[model samples]
Every structure is written in structure tokens, then in C-alpha cells.
Target: MESPSKGYLDVGHLELGGTIQSHSSKFIPSDKAEFNRNMLSRNKIISVCLLLLVITLSGCSRINSAQGWSGILVDDDRLILASMDGHIMVLDKNTGKHMWEPDLMRVKEKDEKKRAAYGLPAVSNGILFVGVYSGKIQAVEVDTGRTVETEV
Candidate 1:
């Protein structure tokens, strides 16, 4: 976010330039007057563009789960969440619902330990990034919901 303290936000008056009449082009400096008009117009355009971008991007993907108070993250437009039991979930953002989740413990030994963490899930470039309690970092596909890479 930009520095909010550096900008002027007036609450004292309704009209711009503090109630100047439309036809009163009295003693305003040309450069300062042009700058004020240009800045106002530019800020309005930029604000609208930013609003549109946020709405469009936030519609991309989302994910939520019934895990034990875990966390989630966005992988590009895809959503990734994790459970305390090492289960990974992926979702489509438009609905805040899961698209896929895998039983990470299914193929492991029955005595395998579970991965748990207090940190929020992290994702990047279509890869759902996560860390296990055993010190392993894992990255999975945001689309197919498969483990694409892993490291310590």
C-alpha cells in the first residue's frame, strides 16, 4: 500500500477547492491549477482500475476446508489449504470451496506421524507450498492436486 499519510483527505467541505464558484477563475496559479485538476482525474482513473482488478482477480480461485483450524493460500488463481493431519486441499476461488484434496497418509506406513503447523499455507506459481513437521517442504500442483516437487 502507498503511504496514506502523504495524501490530503478533506472532510471539512463538500465542494472542491473549498466552495469555489464554477465561473470564478480568480487568482489561481496556472501550474498549480493544472496539477490539481490532472491529479484528481488521474487518481480517479487509477482507483477505478484498481477496483476492477481486485474484483476480477479475486474471482479466480478460492478454497476452504474442514481441517483442524489450519490455513490456506492462493496459488496464482488457485486456492490451497492444509489440515493439521498433513492433508492438502485445492480449490476454485470463485466459490471458496475445495476442488481437490489428497490423503497424504494413505500410501504411507500406518505408523507415520502427522504434519502440523500454526503457519498459514503458502503457494506460488501454481504450486502449493507447504512445510511438514519433519522439516520437508512440499509443492503440489494447484490444478491436478498432485505433488509436483518436494525438498527439505
Candidate 2:
């Protein structure tokens, strides 16, 4: 394989039992050094841009996935809340104590984002209905925390 030549002048030819030499008066050592410095600075700029892009994407994911806000329903003395992580929590309205263990209402689907609750819970005829971001509605008995039905 043969490699391509650069900007050097091909002024001399090789002879049998002789040496070949070439020189270009237009080339300067300082110009080569400046070219290298320019390339280095360009690489640094590109690297910093990529790093900033990664940081921005990570921050956006944290903002979207973080859990905190969810709607709550006060049914009689019990406080019913839907957690952002796809669970139903029943708490006492007055003392703020857990009425029952938090129940798993929805789960993450394959190739989908994590399940989250975004709407207020509803109670009708002693049944609590909670809607999740995964397009499912979970119904449970508000008194016993028993599962009544689920619609997906």
C-alpha cells in the first residue's frame, strides 16, 4: 500500500547509487505548530460541547422521573393518595397515619417509561378509582384496601 504525500515539494529525483532530497522554501516550522494548536483547540471545543449535551440530557431525565406531586382524595376520615411511582397509599386524614400498606397499582411496561399517577382519585359507592399514566385505572375498596377491579 502507498500513502498519499502532503504539501512537501517533490523537487529532486532518485538516481542509481545516489541519494534523493527535496526542500520547499514556502514551508515554515511555525506554521506547522500553529496548525497543530488549532486542531487541539477544535478538539477541546467539541469535547466540551459533548459533555454539556450529556449533562443537559441527564438533568432533563431527572426532572421528568422524579417523584413528589400527586393528587389525593379525602374520603371520610381516610386520605387516599396516588403515588407517582404507581402505588395507592391510604392515610388517616386527621393524624396522617398509614391506614394500610401501600398497594402496587401499576407497573412499568416493556419498552415504556415508568408508571406514574397524574390524576385525582375518585370514590363511588365505597370504591376508590385511581388513574395512572400507563393508561390503567385501579379500583379498590376504600375501607379494606381490597382490590375491586382494574381496567387497562
TM-score of each: 0.43, 0.50
Model 2: CA > 4 A from native: 1-60, 63-65, 102-114, 150-152
Highest TM-score scorer: 2
TM-score of 2: 0.50
lDDT per residue for candidate 1 within 16-135, as digits (tens), equals 666632222235557778999999999999999999999877765344433463676765665666666667766677886667654242212133454654367676676666666655
What C-alpha lDDT values do all the predictions have? 0.59, 0.70
Model 2 over residues 1-152: C-alpha lDDT tens digits?
Answer: 12225654445454556654443433445788799999999999999999999987886575656664478788899888877777778888999888775533343334234556678988999888877676777677887778875554
**How big is the positional error of residue 119 in model 2, measured in Å on the Cα after superposition?**
0.7
Worst 10 residues of 1 by lDDT: 103-112
